[model samples]
Target: MTEQRQDPILIVGGGMAGALLALLLRHHGASAVTLVESHPLTLPDEPPLTPSFDARSTALSAGTLSVLDELGLAEAIREHAAAIDTVHVSRRSRLGITRLRASEEGVPALGAVVENRWLGFVLLRALYADAAIQVLAPERLSAIRRLADGYEATLESGRTLTTPLLIAADGAKSRTREWLGVSARDSDTGHDAMIANLSLASDHQGIAYERFLNDGPLALLPLPDRRFGLVWTGPRDQVDAWMEMESGALLKQLQQQCPAEAPRITGIGERQRYPLILTHACAQAVPFGVVVGNAAHTLHPVAGQGFNLTVRDLVQLACTVGGASAPGKLSLLQQYVQRREQDQALISQASRWVPEMFRVQQPLFAHSRQLGLVAMDILPGLRQGFARRAMGL
Candidate 1:
């Protein structure tokens, strides 16, 4: 029998959450950590250019920015992110439009939109710069065993690592969760989101727009180079049809849908599609393992809060671990769970409920949503609260 050996905290999935958590842990003086990713760390040649933009982008809220700032990554992120000063929410059939301005909340910008790949690059840069954190790319976890003092993980390369804590940030389809016997409840909403980048004829002026149509929500987020990132959600069939349409035809349809901004639309970039699924793990932490990011809770991208929420998860987990004598000990892990459960539950419930409420065809619910937007516009406290929450403050 192979003898057990002590290993650093094991982080599965080298995506945003995993990378950020590793950085934060190192920043907080927790040096012994290892991050494993299935994909290679090196950027690909030609970088997969298409009309479809990155499959994911995140709006970094003020609180999240501060968290990154503390970790010394804000400057790096800002160098590549596009600042958004306002958000406009409207209905396609109605004239009702609600605008949220950063000035109203006393912030220089509402948030920043950044491509997922770029963010990954920045995180990898930071991790490499840190001596305490070791990242293993192109390696995947193949098995996990829980022991009295810690956990042991066997990677696909036939190597075994023993650590007291395991963090699962492998995203919605996390293999680590399954290996650990963690069950997740997932609901397929029968919707898919089509995302793309477009060169607009006019500048977005740092405004993010969300339009609710009879189908689903369509959002236009500002990006660099006079380009805008779009997330269009609708029924599976409709989304599939849109995906099948010729680039020119789809551009025309987009122009019609976004009349105020159509003139700015010019060339389309790589287009991608993702099926929407709402997934929540039964628990965030167990004896020696914990789930984070999409692995913990996956929500509709309509509100653009999915990644933001994941960042918050990392923040909370960091705090809990930092406060402990040994970062991954079982007692500390329990405290982590206790501290994060309420917030996670609240967000998950709200995400699930809000979409259903808006998806309803009932006139009363529509009126309520419209009214809620208006209320958010006029109520300073309410808007500030939301902004703060979104920022992960």
Candidate 2:
């Protein structure tokens, strides 16, 4: 390979997806990578600590964990993580309930939960330690112009660099996607997700719960220290009211909402809310640039599938680009997107459809859902298939 083959593959937006992509590229034998983040990047001796009750978290599906393990990052992440051995899903005020156990699935755990800060810390630490990677933080993309063979990009600091490939992992509302003339189609789910960490009276026992109520889905993901990360989605007014309630009142309301099998909620922490929207980029690859992560698709959090899907996309992208003579070749990029179409489409559709399916108030829909849940629980093959999909396998 000539020096040109090692030319920096510029990546904009050094958040979780961008940072992870840089490392995955290197892991796939890409020699040079550049990561750009508008926010300052630093590696503190210790991961930033948040009050146990206040930190937000993400559940890493089993397949995602395997990818990280291949990158040699799982050990450090496991230190601050919580294992999810079982997932119990049910509908409130309904007779249907089902549990997916890692034991049945023959995996160590269905997934793991880690605070967002810690995950970022692990990714950034690895990126910073890699001599083959270049970090350009506290900087933003000013402009990008496409050339016949590559792209020339200017940073906010007025520095110019050229690369055959540019990646947009900026986020759901990615400006880079816009600069590349890619548009996103966003569908409002007519609900807001209120998130908080709950102090459980008893341990979570490695169980995560997804309970569908009259309003929306309530996801309780186990976190370390006997706390559960809560994502309660409902009407805006309801979420606002719950956000304003005193801790005791909020805990009582949560207790009422949760299943009888759920752990007791002793306290609730700082609350944050965001509207639920399903966003999909009209195109994932354009010329010298390709979109990934939230930039490519932002799914409903009902299934905790967004980041896990992004990880799979990044892994596929690394494999595709690593084997190409020209990383930004339009044909290669298109091939990558085409190969990922089925998985991405399935997961994205399921994420949007799950809440909508449960939201149907008709008696017929209700009975069908009950039958479906019951069938899934009683049938080993059906339950295993559902479990595998949820695990991002």
Candidate 3:
């Protein structure tokens, strides 16, 4: 019988973040890395339908795309992604509109949007191709015992293994984080998001639209083949009602709410909805275990900052621990959390603030919000700063 060998690093979760972290670690020459996931890994011909990489789509910031380029996965992604040449922000029945353009920012493109399934497929292919990564799906980390050097983990199948480093990329309701005694603060945004693919009557021309309506913000992100990925947010009951509406009625409602500049909504695909909640872990690292991705922080989708921020965290963490002699050192993990504190705080605040700022129906606040959008348009420096942040620069 072949004996099970101890791995230097063990990552729990095989979603986008977890899988990408394994790839990044391998890219940085980290060997003997084992990834444990509860979900079954999909076949090469089938796109993964994991919770993180289901029918939903994601906007990849320029910074993230750059990281992918370094990892040599950008070309595969670019084939399916639609560039974001401009981001147009407007308020319903308001007098102000702001457009942040990639040309003005002196970049090729601000970002791009790709289906999460394809992204997952790319990562899975890379993981399987790398001999250094040991992917164990259809498996679960049942328990962990803290050791002086790291952790001793037991799997559901009664297999035992030890790793010097443990990472919790299991997502927002991370069992690994809980096992490590990390507490999370979850704030319900009082809103739910309905997402689906949209077919437009006209070309989107690579323009992403953010229209703030009375109920909630609606984002129509450009996608290939004259389609857009829709993130429509509102109260749970309202969204549920919309979910039940006939396609034609729903499209009509979207047309009424969307900005006139956006392409007409031609058709809608299967829709899914979930409550919007902002969650932040009280602490990011514990002794030898570290929390990453949605396990550490889950932000609102209003600004599309959630996954992008997670990618940044993964990159920094990989750079910090990859190829290190003591990969699971507590001090090193703490340092990784420290370096990410500012970025995490800022993006979380912004994600929360955007929706609240627009939710207020008061006259003075409305006027101020309108003026703010106008200012962002007229002031090059102001818009540039915002653009840079949004692009993850």
Candidate 4:
């Protein structure tokens, strides 16, 4: 593709990754960056009916936290984020427990949790205020054409735009990725993750718990305002049953599984469920563009590694393409893909294997799992390394 200095960079998704990518590009001195979103570009004074604008939370690691500076987001996320000082991992009905402490690693906190709506508010507010970034709302990509000099996209609203570089920042099911003819490797876990908010009877004390239960992995994250965020992964039938169960019954079940010292789960918030799948785009780049975020590699929410890894690559990509005369050149895009190999592969394997090993019913596997946790706790170096990686350091 030929270079055109005046042609703007088009990003196809206004979600966290897409919006943040636009900001990052701008940080790299890109003159014009455009973000196309499927939902209405405008957020009314009253809350809108968007899934992202909800009580559901996003876990932000110390590493992913750099997105604020990298993307030129001036607002502080601390007030909206609940600090995670420690993460206590365990196996239900087992005698294994390991604690990952931020203090032990010489970091102030391991990570932080912020509600999706709050994060969206901050990000969108910045996007709308920035004149360099153009946002097209209530529009979707209907068709794409690969040009000798670049690429062309026609939106559902009949709006046409062309640029030398087009990025697919759309979510897991990315239409842009499809248009680019990039194939993704997907694995269904045969489990569904049910998410909701939990009102705690006692303060969480800045601790998050990841428990391996018979059904699957259950994670309860500490939140601000004396609450907790639950990501309960289990078989479809069990998840469906839990979703229909009364709040009191659900509370009782959670209390039974929770740590003795943990505060009683008194109230439940809106419950939403989605199938768990691991997706990785076989090809991240081709002439004239590349795919990123969930579209490039949709990961299990095991350690909340999905967005952290994506953000890292976004930063690298901005640097790689920032001053290059031909940003859409194949060689430059290949370099970006090469730089991400190690982290992506390692995290993907961990997210897939951890659940399987813990979920096994065999006594041998169970004992081995317990031993692993014990080793992780006893070995200081191992523990520190894990803590650092988990915090996205």
Task: List model 1 lDDT by residue over 1-393, tens digit each.
Answer: 994434577899887788888988767656478999887776432221111123566777777777888988888888878998888877776545667788987888878988877777777777877776887878988888878866888999999988878889898889898877889999998999998988987778898888877788888888877888899988999998998999999998988888374346888888888998888888777777888888989988876887777777787788777435556666777777787777777777776676666677888878888888778778878877866666566
Q: Count backbone clashes in candidate 2.
A: 0
Supply candidate 4's per-residue lDDT for 117: 77
CA displacement after TM-score superposition, residue 232 of candidate 3 (Å): 0.3
Model 3 ranges with Cα > 4 A deviation: 1-6
TM-score of each: 0.92, 0.96, 0.97, 0.96
Residue-level lDDT of model 3, residues 173-228, one tens digit each, is 99999988899999997889999999998999999999998888999999999999
Give me the candidate number with maximum lDDT: 3
Give the least accurate 10-residue stretch of model 1, judged by summed lDDT: 45-54
- The regions of model 4 sitting more than 4 angstroms off are 1-4, 44-54, 70-75
Clashing pairs in 2: none
lDDT for each residue of candidate 2 in 32-140, tens digit (9 for 90 to 100)? 8999887777667765332211256899999999999999999999999999999999998888889999999999999999988899889888998999899997789
Clashing pairs in 4: none
Candidates, ranked, lDDT = 3, 2, 4, 1
Question: Looking at candidate 4, what is the lDDT of residue 138?
Answer: 72
Task: For residue 255, give model 4's deviation from the true position in Å.
Answer: 1.2
